[model samples]
Target: MTSNPTSSPDPIPNIATASEAFHTGDELRERWRALMGPLGFSERLLWFAFVDTTGHILPALNQLPLDGPPEPYLADLLMYRLSDVIDGHDVVSVAMLITRPGADAITPWDRGWARLFTTAADLAGVAIEPIFRANAVDLVQVSDPRADGRSVA
Candidate 1:
């Protein structure tokens, strides 16, 4: 008998677990609250991967998949890859967030960041956004000034 080269085994190593599945906003909100806990700017404020969609990749207290690749482990690599995609013409589905020092706030987009975000979104073909509220502000993107049909910031 010939074994199939492209077959997933029972214990598929790369398959997403139930917990690894995409999280809804509500579910993520609960998780975020739990993560935030009672620490008032005491714990590290960072943006772990939320729903990285063409819509919005929220950077806040959100339900992290109990089993997804941790942010730090993939941040640098993800950024480099994203840059390459923006600079190159490869499979351009991109979404990500950055960690910063704050209290349940996202790293606001500056002029430099706006350029990066705008470029990435344009190259990404479809669309991608980083969503988060800062210091009780309503949800906002990285605050880009350009209207590239992508960076709604």
Candidate 2:
């Protein structure tokens, strides 16, 4: 019997467990790094993980398609889903990651998505932490002006 080389094991060895605390931006980035593995995706994806005011992460972490649907519709979808988990006690915040297959540099496109989400979260009255971006080279905390609380168009 010959073993198949094509069938490789998953690269991500460990993932964040429920209720794990992420108190700061650095900690959140580390968790994103763990979740993202070596940073490479064939298509664009937006990853979401719920966190509480005390920094404890909720059990739900999901990846959604980045394309299709208008931005407002997508934002509405996200807000609707988030409302189910939020109780204003245990689950009060969210963290996001935008990933794609490309160079590590942050792009305008990335900023646009971040801005849109930031605006949506604001309107929905949800607390949002700093968003992050990942590509073929690196995972980084998004530092765009929009993400920093500037108006989103």
Candidate 3:
């Protein structure tokens, strides 16, 4: 389940430096877009980027295996573990991205994952920015829908 339709090399998008701020959903979505880059993948991956209290991005961008919906218990455990890392920080939040092979549209499955993640973060008392999804066609913000009843990319 993949597509490499382009004969030319795929362009690598620029990554945000540690100094860059991701204060808004738009900024976070841009980061996800850069990380995703003309999306085409054989499997799904969950990516995370931490933001400090001042909105500056942490140095690391994490990637984890994702075969299906996240286990509730595991999600809790993961968030709790990460909480320790930012415990002493002045302020911190999380940004998530799900990249898989598919069309641009957000599916019910994607919404389900977003709900699970939001719930887990709520339980852990962790703040999370909007979540984004990158598919074979486009990258979009999945957590919050626009006022016009549309998803933004």
Model 2 spans > 4 angstroms off: 1-20, 68-70, 146-153
Question: Candidate 1 clash total?
Answer: 1
TM agreement with the true structure for every prediction? 0.32, 0.77, 0.76
Report the candidate with higher lDDT, 1 versus 2.
Answer: 2
User: Judged by lDDT, which candidate is best?
Assistant: 2
Residue 143 error for model 2, in Å?
1.7
Q: Rank by TM-score, descending?
A: 2, 3, 1
- Across 80-137, the per-residue lDDT of candidate 3 in tens digits comes to 8767765636547777888888764788777777767777877887777777777876
> Tens digit of lDDT per residue, candidate 1, span 106-133?
4433234435444544554434443332
Which ranges of candidate 1 are over 4 A from the true structure?
Answer: 1-95, 102-109, 124-126, 130-140, 147-153
lDDT of 2 by residue, 1-153 (tens): 111356553244366532456766766776777767766788888888887767866666798888743377787678767767777777777888888878648887787788778778778777778888888766777786655653211
lDDT at residue 28 of model 1 (Cα atoms) = 34
Backbone clashes (count) for model 3: 1
Looking at model 3, report the run of 10 residues with the lowest lDDT sum: 144-153
